[model samples]
Target: MTELLLVGIGTGNPDHITLEGRKALQGADLILIPRKGPEKSDLAELRRRIVLQSVRDGMDRVVEFDLPVRDPDLPYLEAVERWHDAIAELWAVTLAAHPDAHSAALLVWGDPSLYDSTLRIAARLDPTPKVRVIPGITALQALTAAHAIPLNTLAGSVEITTGRRLRDTGWPDGAETVAVMLDGACAFETLDPDGLQIWWGAYLGMDEQILSAGPLEEAAPHIMRIRAEARDRHGWIMDTYLLRRTGVPG
Candidate 1:
C-alpha cells in the first residue's frame, strides 16, 4: 500500500515549518508539489525551497505537477467536485510514475485540519493510501503571533468561518470573535462597524507581510485600500482576520 503523508508547512515562512513536518519531508520517498501557473509560482517555489532545506535528498524525489483550475461558470459544489476529480486523477498518474515508491508526501499550507482539502482528495484515490498528516502552524496562529495578540480573550469563544458565510450571515450567535478566511472580498465591511475590533493581516509571516488592527470602524477602510494595493502589486493575496465584539468578554 502506498503511504501518503500531508505535511503542513504553514504560511510562507520557512521557520513556520514544524520539526515533525521536517522529519516527514526527510522520510518521504516521493514529494509532490503542485504548480498553479506563473501567477502563483511563489507558492510552488516556497515548497521546493522548504523541501531542499529539510531533506538532503529532496530534489531528486520531488515531482512538480500542474493544478487543475475550477471552472468558474459551474455551481460552487459542482465546480469543486470536478476540480477535485481532476486533481485526484492527476495524483494517480503521478503516483503511477514512481512505481518503486511506497511513501509520498505533499506540502500543505497551514494545518491540514483547517480549511485544507488534501485529505478529502486523498480519499478519492482508488484503494486509498494509508494517510498521515503532520500539522503545521495555521494562518490563525501565524496571524496572531505576528501581531502579538491572543487568539481569544479570557475564555471568550471564537467562531472560525469563511468569507462567503460572513457575507451571507452576519456575526454568528455566541461568537465573541470571528476569524474569517477565504474572504478575498473583505466581507467584514458588510457588518455594522460599531463596537467591533478587527485584526487583519495579508501574506502573514512572509517578507511582504502587512498587518493592521484597531476599532473596526476606523480601520476597515484603510485595510481595504491596503489590501487592494498589495494584491495588485503581488498579483495574488492570501489574508485572514479576526473580528471581535468590543467589551463583550463578560
Candidate 2:
C-alpha cells in the first residue's frame, strides 16, 4: 500500500517549518514538489531550498510535477474540481513510476486543512493511499506572528474561512474575528467599514512580505495597491487577512 505524507511547509519562510515537519521531510523516501509554471517558479524554489537546508539526508529523491491549471471557461467550483482531479491523476502516475519509493511526501503550502485541496485530491487515488497529515504553521498563524498580535480576542472566538465564502455569505454571524484567504477581489469593500479593523499580510513570513493593519476603510486601499504590485512583479500573490470588530470583548 502507498503511504502518502502531506507535510505543511508554512508560508514561505524555511524557519517556519516545525521540528516535526523537518523530521517528516527527512523520513520521506520521495518528495513531490508541484510546479505551477515559470510564473510561480519561486514557490517551487522555496520548497527546494527548505529541503536542501532541513533534510538530514541530502540524497533523498526530490521530484517535480507540473501542476494542473484551472480552466477559466468553467464555473469556479467546477474548474477547481477538474483541476484537482487532474492533479490526482498526475500524482497517481508519479507514484506508479516510483513503485520502489515508500513513504512519499508532498510539500503543502501552509496547512493542508486550510483552503488547500491536496488532501481531497489524495483521497481520489485508485487504491487510496494511506494518508498522514503533518501540520505546520498556517498563513493565519504566520500573519498574526509577523504582526505580534493575538489571533483571537480575549475570551472570544475566531472564524476561519475562504474569500469565496466571505463574498457569498457576508460577515459571519456572532464572529468577532474573521480570517479571509484566497480572495482576489477585496471582499472587505462589501462590508461595513465602520468599527472594523483589519490586519492584512501578503507573502507572509517571506522577505518580500507586506503587512498592514488599521481601520478597514483606511487600510483597504493600501492592501489593494500592495497586492496589485506584488502580483504584477511576481505574477502571483498569496495573501491572508484578519478582520476584527472594533469593540473589545466584555
TM-score of each: 0.98, 0.95
TM-score winner? 1
lDDT of 1 by residue, 1-250 (tens): 3799999999999888989899998989999999999988989999999998999989999998999999999988899999999999999999998899999999999889998889999999998999999999999999999889889878888789999999999889878889999998999999999999999998988999999999999999999999999988888999999998889753
Q: What is the lDDT of candidate 1?
A: 0.92
Task: Return model 1's CA RMSD, one decimal.
Answer: 1.1
Cα displacement (Å) at residue 20, model 1? 1.3
Q: State residue 249's C-alpha deviation in candidate 2, in Å.
A: 2.8
Clash totals for all candidate models: 0, 0
Off by over 4 Å in 1: none
lDDT of 1 at 171: 84
Give the TM-score (vs. native) of candidate 2: 0.95
Candidate 2 residues lying further than 4 Å off, grouped into runs, are 56-60
The root-mean-square deviation over C-alpha atoms between each candidate and the true structure, in angstroms, is 1.1, 1.5
